[model samples]
Target: MLFNASQQWEKCVKQIEERDRLIFVSVYVLIFVAGLILNLIALVVFFFHTKTRSHTTVYMTNLAFADLCLVCTLPVRICYHLGVSLHQRLCEAMGMILLINMYGSIFLLSCTSVDRCVAVCFPMSSRVREVRKKAPFICLGVWIMTVGASLPIYFIKPQLPGYQNQSKCFGSFPVYGTRPVAITSSLTVGFGVPLLAMLVSSWGLLRAIKRSQAAQTDLVDSRKIQRMIAMCLVIFLCCFLPYHLSLLLVYLHQRSIPCSLTSSYNYSLMVACLNAMLDPLAYYFTTETFRKKVDLDALRQMWPMQSQSQSADHHSRGPLNT
Candidate 1:
């Protein structure tokens, strides 16, 4: 009987290794390379290259920083997948940084949407414009809060004694042996609330845009508003929904279900990290000033003489007016 049990355990371990190790390594490598490059570009462009300090720029700067922080954690994760053992404290710290930045990205992305919604809905309100100046402080608060919230997870260690290999890092962390509460709370706070906020802001933005269009309010840039709403909706659907659903499946698996979502969970997580790459696209496509600055910089670099000659001509061109 003992021999049979050991054989079954070895089979289970082999199956898991065969199913996930390659996938994890491949996905992490892709995300790490892509996300690292994209977020670094975004950080440089948004932080130092651009001259604008508008509300959109503020939130996007925060978002870029958040994504950069998250992408930095990928190497550690990839090292773990490649069979490099890490100290428990280092693993926990990496996990905390990942969660903190992931949630920070979610919040800042939502903030950018809200900023657009308010600007559109209250186009003539000086008060709304006044509140826009508070964006930096708001972004600071978000970073602090997310970091604080994720810190507790560092203390919630895994208890998978026999499955020691799986218990390291984020694979089987904050294990829900009997207490489902922790996972539920994390799901609600980390995923559900952010998603709901994005949906609400998007809906409100759409309504405001329509109303302003009907009233012929020229104060709001209808195109910009549409772009913000579209980006938020796409990120929520593509990056967030699948990962959180996989989390739900994982939770259900912990409750003794016969479902095998381990691969699903890992792949969905990779999908989530793709947001770090996709965000630069959002900045390029949706944020007009950022796009213009990037284009002008590219032109300047590619043709220094022509850019210097046309600098005065291009100086007065508004964002996306071209």
Candidate 2:
């Protein structure tokens, strides 16, 4: 058994082939073009075309920005897949930028979920106001922390034994060393934590609806939020989840890394890039959120017209104040 295992471990590392290259280039190009157009439109609409800049708007804008940054990294990856010679340092930078912004997008969306939960749970609390005021700071902190965490990737030496073209970043990470650890950490902190946070937010929203007297009026609110939450889950499962899981598998396999595993990881990663394309749905959901607050600024307009309508009806039919 030990001899067989050793033989397996000694199998030759998979090299990039025509099918792998074709799939990689095709998917990456689609993600790049689609993500670029989508994110740019999101940014434009979120920034210049609208007013009423509430915190949820802030979150969605930051999300769009993060997605744009991630989209920018795809061209470099596509270049690598197309057999263009790239410096190892450039490869490292591209990887780190993608890692940083991917987490940035995840964290920002988690913030949106948490913010929505807080707003729902404490509709009129002063703390909610405070949290809204701190939105920019929270986004700042997410960017800082994501960049800091990914800074270590820059320190990872480009060279690994038996690989001469360091630019062939696909084969760069060793199976047993720091790569698996990084993959595990990202799977935990990057994807797992955010997923749990979104679920908790969903639960909080459900609980708040149950406890409120105005659930009928807030049904739209609940539905919109539920749809957004479902979209987030879909993005995670289709994009981040499989990519990270396959990535961990490829990085941890002690035996010869199979072409199939590498292919799976590559394809899933391209799917992950589609999160940018899907993020516009979040903007649509949150755009109508908390809009009932201010009259004008970039994004936010409101779900609470029912409350105001009921109040107006009571005032109009009951009496004209002296």
Candidate 3:
């Protein structure tokens, strides 16, 4: 029982997986390649560059690390799909890594949103800057809390009756079965609070941006903050929302989740995992030095030079800075 789906669907579940294995393999492989490259580049820019100064850097660096760890789990998932030999301990470890990093990424993104919201709302508040100065300590607390939340990994098991086979790496969490209260409580604590925090903070940022525009105030970091908010909102809504909603539906069913819902739940998880790749885009938005340091812009120089030269022929060069 992978969630509330029981053993009865195991045969049908296997059939569903087999039928759509190509799509599954393709998606995971694409995610693995893209997420790996993006997160690695982010790590290089964040850690290998100068000492961290901004709270955004601290949160994004942790987010990148979490994403890196999350993408590493895909190869194991791919192998499992391909019917390759996998040990029990390796499977359990994969599950552990997946859960830890997944929640870690979510919380870290929320932290970034909150940080930006505070900065915009309290632009001159020294107290806010002081809190930003203590970013590393804050990040450490987030990590510890994320790990503690992931402690229920032991509760996951295959939900099939008489299912003693150790072939599968993961199973349905029993909390989804006959325990709607437990599921709702945990779900609310684990994902609900972060969702609310992100929403409130992002709303604060959006309104500030609107007010600034209404007054024609040229805020220095307004564009950067806009990009950051866009990335965070899209990832949370497009990726994470579906999965949590699916979990809620499964549990609220109060019985074995239907085969149709089971498949949808699995797909929602795939959507959630996509934030690993998308998180790196947020780094580009929230951090200034990351843009300066990343080698990707080297390619941009090649394309823009000819345009810069052609425009110089017709018009006097002026400050290109926007």
Please tell me which predicted candidate would have the highest TM-score against the true structure: 3
> On residues 42-69, what C-alpha lDDT tens digit does candidate 1 reach at each position?
7787668777667778888788888888
Assess candidate 1 and give its TM-score to the true structure: 0.75
In angstroms, the error of model 2 at 38 is: 1.5
Would you list the C-alpha lDDT of every candidate in the order shown? 0.66, 0.67, 0.68
- Measured over all alpha carbons after superposition, the RMSD of each candidate to the real structure, in angstroms, is 9.5, 6.7, 9.6
Better of 1 and 3 by lDDT: 3
Q: Choose the strongest candidate by lDDT.
A: 3
Where does the lowest 10-residue lDDT sum fall in candidate 2? Answer: 293-302
lDDT (Cα, 0-100) at 218 in candidate 2 = 38
Error of 1 at 107 (Å): 0.9
Candidate 2 Cα misplacement greater than 4 A, ranges: 1-16, 158-165, 174-181, 210-224, 289-322
TM-score of each: 0.75, 0.78, 0.79
lDDT of 3 by residue, 207-274 (tens): 75555532233323455556667766877889888888877786676355567776777788888889
Q: Which residue ranges in model 1 land beyond 4 Å of their true spot? A: 1-14, 158-167, 173-181, 213-228, 257-259, 289-322
